[model samples]
Target: MSQELIQAVMVLTKQKGFAPEVIFESLEAALLQAYRKEPHSNPDAYVELNRETGAYKVMAKKQVVETVEFPETEISLLDARKIDKRYEIGDIVEADVTPANFGRSAAHTAKQMLIQRLKEAERSVVYEEYYSREGDIITGVITRVEGKNVYINLGKTEAILPPTEQIATETYHEGDRIKCYIVEVKKTTKGPQIMISRTHPGLLKRLFELEVPEIFEGVVELKSVAREPGMRSKIAVYSRDENIDPVGAC
Candidate 1:
């Protein structure tokens, strides 16, 4: 790889929030797979990346033996000594099996592989982030409406608000700012699929924490919540201190 390409890769990985070591691992795995797919590739092939020079090599790691029984994994001592005189019978040698001008097709394939891996990494990150926020409230904008189902954009990922989970009196439309409780988060092949609900009792409890300063500051302890969705709701609260009134604060 050239210095310019290496710099571009570094910038893109940073932008994508990928660590350098993970990027290197992904590239190395991609290179090894590419090497194996070539017509004259060895089965015991490996990939080597020069971090300082931005140069990479795809070669076979073979053990030097007196008689070559498995040519792919073991090389003749005479043949190994031709490349390096110090190669002994039990020594291991790296024989360069890199193709001529691999930068053309192989480079394109490597870029594609990196992008695919990066997307998977991003999805995993989103899943972990939202998974921890389960039973918590999230603010999102209604982006799409499909009859009974609605999709809300929550910055990094979109969440599904089914009709069953929606408030009975709420008529959601595009661009509506809505607060929902994250009921569930699933890891799907396309991406992270989140199930959000506006009618859940947890949503009302979370809304109280946000709206009431006493609850947020831990002065008031919220005991329980019961809601009939869009109609009526009941909450039980108590103050930890003598002077604070939790019922009046809400």
Candidate 2:
């Protein structure tokens, strides 16, 4: 079971591009929760997992005191000294409380919890990745059209191009590859919702940046854009160098 857990974590880390530490932390937390629900579990116990070996131990933290008022949270100095002779009254002793038989049901519960945590982490990673691209242009293939929404497959995730964001005269079909400007990115319970647009002025601005070397290199600046969806659009431009003609560059 321990070897299997380690192998699963490694597979997920490689396939999902997630850091190993993130997976380990999530798994440890999940296992800790599962351990807490066991029959003889201690409230003051925590899980210590070996990253390399995947072995885990549930340890209870007890403070050494002259008088053990709380048996669960405190240990008498004499008892503590028995475990470790150097232990003092004020010292903290971590006692292994791992179950002799951590049943199959408990392991199953831990697996489910780990899966849930990994999904949430994946959603957060996807949200942050697309959120940073909000105002940028991306190319994707139209996957499907549902009512007034067109779904585009952007390799890693899907994006929504709503009717309001589409060009008035344009028609969308599945398998058609197109470019869109990312307007907004939202994190929802379902997942990351990427709102893209075909008619946004930023789309033309981005096109200019992609096609024109002068604009992309900062020698030519695109001042503003006025567009009428599928109709013609106009852009104002200026050049930093007097020798460079921004209009000719465009």
Candidate 3:
């Protein structure tokens, strides 16, 4: 890699919220793909970066042999000795054979591999970030409507608020702002999927938690919640602090 390439990679890593090590790992996999394109290129290659210079190198392993059966796996002792004098049969030798550009086709392969790895990394990040938010309330903007289901944009992810999960009296339109409870979070091939509900009992509890400080502070406790999605719900509450009025708090 050159200075220009390193700078470009750094910019992309920061912009895409990817770690440098991840980008470099993807680069290593990309280089292996580039090697696959060139038969002379070593498959058993180790990619390393210069600590001081910030340059990349491709290393190869060559095994010494008396009579070479597999040309790629074994190298004659005579040829091995030319690279290193202490070469012995079955001994593996490491060689440097880094290529420049690796041709347009190889570069394209590397780009595609990097993109695929980056997408997987992004999905993992989204899943880890949202998984813990189950049962919590999230504010979202309605983005689309497909039949009875509404898709809401919640910053990092789009949540599906199904018809069965919607409140009975409330109506939504595109760009309408709404709050929903995160009923579940699932990992799919596309990305992290957040299933939200407007009529879940958890939604009312969470809304109360947001509206009343006593519940949030643990002075008032919500004992039970039951709901008929899209209709009405029931909640039972108790207060550890006798001085606190649970109903008044709500």
Candidate 4:
């Protein structure tokens, strides 16, 4: 265990947006997989991390027995006693075989596995974040228009604005900024698909909800809405209290 490694892991935990425990868990799984890839790797091999020091150990758990029928899982009592005098038959013994300290190939294998786990964790963070903001409005730049699909740049990723959701009257061009409501945020094989809409009725409702504080504060209630989207639309409003004029306030 080195103080340098501990500090490095602490910095990585912040950068990767993972807790200390999560990093340790990922490391343990990676180390175990690395150990299994070795020619002499044992199925009973497991890995553990030193939480405070950031040191990890790959260990094979073997049961101490009078006769070692399975060398991978059982160790002779005499051999176990040589390592530790307290060892007796039926006792479990752990063999410390930390790959980094003992071998090169095993260490490389573990490193590759850890990299993959980190990438997947990053994707999960993005998915959960956008999924929470589904059904909300975001302003993005039109990156491209191909056939009936419009691609919008949402900073972190691109969202698709299908033809049905585009405004018929509005002219779209590259780099044009537009406000679109997020109809859905879906996780697909290609990654997150943020479906945005310019013509959905919810867009108008959301706009009013944002602009008019009375609807948000319960001072006025929105009864119903009828829309010819991006053109003609009518929204009915009612005052919760007779003293306040809903239509005038909107």
| lDDT (CA) per prediction | 0.85, 0.90, 0.80, 0.80
Candidate 2 off by > 4 Å = 38-44, 65-69, 76-79, 103-105
Best of the two (2, 3) by TM-score: 2
Model 3 residue 66 CA deviation in Å = 6.6
Which 10-residue span in candidate 1 carries the lowest summed lDDT? 32-41
Count of residue pairs whose backbone atoms collide, per candidate? 0, 0, 0, 0
Output the TM-score of candidate 4.
0.81
Q: Tens digit of lDDT per residue, candidate 2, span 72-94? A: 67889999988999999889999
- State the number of backbone clashes in model 3: 0
Q: Which of the predicted structures, 1 or 2, would earn the higher lDDT when compared with the native?
A: 2
Candidate that scores best on lDDT: 2
- Residues 109-175 of candidate 1: C-alpha lDDT, one tens digit per residue: 8877877887888899899999999999999999999989999999888888998998888798899
Badly placed stretches (over 4 Å) of model 4 are: 1-24, 50-54, 97-103
Question: For model 4, how does the per-residue alpha-carbon lDDT over 9-30 read when each residue is reduced to its tens digit?
Answer: 6877877767877667877888
**Candidate achieving higher lDDT, 1 or 4:** 1
- Name the lDDT value of residue 12 in candidate 4: 74
Judged by lDDT against the true structure, how good is candidate 3? 0.80
Q: TM-score of predicted model 2?
A: 0.91
Q: Candidate 1: misplaced stretches above 4 Å?
A: 1-4, 78-84, 100-102, 217-219
